[model samples]
Target chain A: MSKKWLSLISMVLAIGMVAVLAVGCGGPAKTDSTEIKIGGDFEITGGVANFGKSTVNGIQLAFKEVNAKGGILGKKIVLVLADNKSEPSEAANAITKLITQDKVVTVLGPVASSNVLAASQIAIDNKIPLLTATATASKVTVGDDGKVKDYIFRACFIDPFQGEVMANFAAKSLKVKTAAIYVDNASDYSKGLAQVFEEKFIKNGGQIVAREAFLAKDTDFKSALTKMKASNPDVIFIPAYYQEVGLIVKQARELGMNTPMIGTDGWDSPKVVEIAGAAALNNTFFSNHYSPEDKDPHVTSFVEAYKKEYGQVPDALAALGYDAALMLIDAIKRANSAEPAKIKDALAQTKNLQVSTGILTLDASHNPVKSAVVIELKDGKQTFKEKINP
Target chain B: MDSSSFLMQFAQQLINGVSLGSIYALIALGYTMVYGTIKLINFAHGDVYMVGAYIGFFATTVLGLGFLPALLLAMVGAGILGMFIERAAYRPLRNAPKIAVLITAIGVSLFLEYGSMLLVTPQPRTFPAVLSSTPIHIGGLIINSQQVLILGVSLFLMVVLTYVVNYTKLGKAMRAVSFDTDTARLMGIDVDKVISYTFAVGSALAAAAGVLVGVYYNSIDPLMGIMPGLKAFVAAVLGGIGVIPGAMLGGVLMGVIEALVSGFISSTFRDAAAFGILIIILLFKPAGLLGKNIREKV
Candidate 1:
């Protein structure tokens, strides 16, 4: 009787272990319910942490609003966020983990153009849809055939458009017949903008009197500024991030080079004022996505909600992030499924979507066709000057 | 090419290079002096320079002090930091292997750099422009007041250091300690005091360099000192490590070479040319330009 009882107990224990093992090894149990999982890789902690954190907050708010409105296709959308540390290799790894580990169908972010370029290849290989929020490099979407890829989309206009807008403004409005460009040789974004701006300005009968280059981390612009001053340009074009831009402007002014300066979207940072004082930035201008003074209801609502959520006014980066999330949700709803191919098709067909920035229509290259706002610096504050549709 | 035009450009480039070279020499003095006495490379020396920049930034921006006062306070604050770093990190490893000390130095460097990043924003800040905005014209070439100030201060410091090392009693004790710590200690000199003083002096020079460069460039960042520090180290090595005047000579030579290469060849190859010169110099003169050959006791 004792032996029979022990055998039965042993058999029960063995069966329980097998059940646990089976559940553990068979992957997550898929509920027969409605839920769509999306992932995001952002540089939440690095040199550009402030921008990344704001972008993440914008995305999360969009997801929350969508879920409150009864999520896409009657399914609640879930977002899984990961930090990429602003490194290209880490961005790729984070995206890989998102797709393989989290089982997310669509991914968003990795904000900087360089990181987006590095990580998008993984999405391409895995056949997952990636909608970048703020990366504006023209090459982000165009392939060897000069066509948009099936898997990648961006919510921002490319660098060429931004470059042309600034060049046109400098030539026509500023009425500068000669200009000099000081570009960050190490940055692809800066190089691209400088190339396009030079090409367009020269074509418009503006002579590039000087073309000087410096490294990204260099702080000293005296020598470069001195060289530029010798060329006697009326205006200078600096297409780099705000950190370097601030120093360059201050150094240029300090060296007695009083040339008016213009820049691209990279100049939209509060740190610019903090670094280069208001005195140095008095006559600066730049091309940006949208101005806070824009009277569009969508933009105003986004501004209010963003201020309420973040306790600060949202910049172009935050607005682009919100728009990217909204557009992705809209695509998911139109496709009615989270399959990569279907979402890509829906994104390719995106049109007339009134985002916070403007009514964005996805061009053939998966870039947005929208208006670029020109902002001028007065007393270290950015004020809306004009808006040009390209 | 006409000799006059070539001479004019060459003179201008030389002045620009020397101004930059003086800043490098000021920072290199810190590295070479510390290595001269301790036989350990303080990798955190660069971060010390970075901290000095921040100190000046805060002193001016937040504390609202005058330029001279801010510079003095920055030097003092950086000196204290150097003392603390030596006490906490290097004091306990006084008897450790040279490699261990080197590793600790690197670790301290990373700690200071990342710590600064966490404390302050990683974005570069534009240093306030207070120096003379006027460019002094010499014939066809022009030089700024900041460059003149940097060159004057660096030369003054080098001369003062040379005087101290050759004449002062404390300087004699330092030299004695560097030559043979045991013998110096046996002869009634406090070796620890000498080493600490060495660090204090080195850190003071680095702080001055940091502040000067900040004013010169009109920008400061947490990671600004790494490349400059490395280049200065290379300059020290090129001039003969542990030799005071050699460091200054090496820095000026390196600077002029870099400027010439960028002006003549390409800016892309400037760094390569500087290092290539170092390699060639080291190949011929292993003891450096001013280094002495000392036989190992073992």
Candidate 2:
């Protein structure tokens, strides 16, 4: 009798474990005709939470604005968000879940290029449209062989354009003779921008005085900064993320090497000032998208509304997220169907799509042909300098 | 690039190394003291340092204390926490096997890291400027004010620690217990109290190091302690695990070497250089730099 009871309990336990497993991975897809589903998997936690949070905020705002005006094709939009927890593997899982379980018509986000590269594979495999607004690496849309992937699309100009914009600004606008390059050696994004900046700066008849490399988590750049000081370049180009940029800037000033600094859009976050302090923010410029200081009606209205809603000025991440959402919703409307393939075709033929960033037009490579803005930092406030046209 | 500048850069790197090593030395003191008294590695010692930084962060940000006061409070709070951990985790495992106690230490380490992450979230916080960061220049040598604080505080703590270990009654009791726990118990000395005091002293020192590091680096996260903790342990081992002065010596040397490698060579080889020192040291001196060999009869 005891042996039979033990067998019965084991059988029940096995079934219960399987049921629990099913609940986690097998969130069944539900199809609804009345509302279109849009999925977003963004890093809401972990190291880069600041970036992801802003992106999610922007996406949420766009969806709210669209819904208030009646969502595409007279059907309400059901926005689904999954937190990637700032990890690539988690991003992969979130994207897969959004596609297979949530059955989102077209997915948007996983903001970093590395993450987009990881999460977009599932969308490509399943033939669903995946769009990114901020992932600047050309590889986000283009394959290893230089062919554009059909399903992958980006609203931001590729890394080459960002590097070229900043290099041009340095040469023509600021008119610096020589520059130094310090890049985050671990990031492909940083390396790509650094490479393009080096090439373009030299092409514009400027010389690179010195080049140094450091990893992402490194706190001490004094030795590298000292080397750069020896070269005595007029401007220092740091194509790195905000977390490292603030420290680098602070350390650079402390080391008595007060070369004017230029960085990429990765320096767009407000936390850079918090990290670097206000004193170090002086005499710095960065290339970015859609400055909130723009006088354009669409830009001002969106910025004002976002400020009213979020209680803070929207950063570049927010602008990108809003644009991606707006464009995706527009594609769904243009397609006039909730079908994934129809939406993909519409996105591929995107033209004159007015986004929060600017008037965006996708080339065959899926990168937007939009202008990049150079912003100068003064007293921790971003002052719009001039826009560089592609 | 040139000869004179190279020499200046070398000197600057040395200064940087000394500042960095002092922070390591501060944490290593706790390891040596705890190991000396209890004969346990106390792997959670690093997390105690991490917790100390968070406490300092709150003290400055929430309570609005000055730098020195926040440092003191953090040290005291961590001391209490270290004793609490001892009574809770280590005390129960006293009579257990040595391996069991070691595993428990590892378990406690994980618990503190993950628990802190869950409570505080795994986001990196900018440590507020406890001290100003104006560079103090002397003959092309740029010294950050925070680095000066680290060197000063570590020196003060080390001197006080030396006095306590050499002159205090509690220090005598600690040495007695370290020499022989069973005999110290028979001699009417409270072994448990001495052990707890050792933990308090060590943990307090580690806490002080944590606050100094946060001020120096301007960033702190839950998992930040893991690498530094392992590095401190290696430093402790290098200087002779239970030897107080040895840990300090080991820490300073490690820092100098790390700075040299990163400054003269590539920053890519910085971590590799640290572990490489450990391998070479272990090969030549298994008992450590200051450790003496004693044969045991079977």
> Highest DockQ among the candidates is held by which one?
2
What tens-digit string does per-residue lDDT give for candidate 2 at B163-267? 999899999999999878999999999999999999999999999998988887787778878878888888888998889998998888878777788777866
Q: What is the interface RMSD of each candidate, in Å?
A: 4.0, 2.4
DockQ of candidate 1 is 0.25
Isolated chain A TM-score, each model: 0.82, 0.83
lDDT of 1 by residue, B174-251 (tens): 899888888999999999888888888888888888988887776788899898888788888888888888889988
The top-ranked prediction according to lDDT is: 2
lDDT of 2 by residue, A1-390 (tens): 999999999999999999997875566455677788888888888877888889888988988888899876888887788888888899899999888888888888888888999988888999999998789877899999988898999877887788999999999988999999998999988999999999999999999988888888676677667667767899999999988998899888887777789999889877788888888889999998879897778888889989999999898889988988888888888888889999999898889988876788889888889888899999898898887877
Q: What is the alpha-carbon lDDT of model 2 when measured against the actual structure? A: 0.87
Compared with the true structure, all predictions reach lDDT values of 0.84, 0.87
Q: RMSD (Cα, Å) of candidate 1? A: 7.3
Model 2 TM-score, all chains together: 0.83
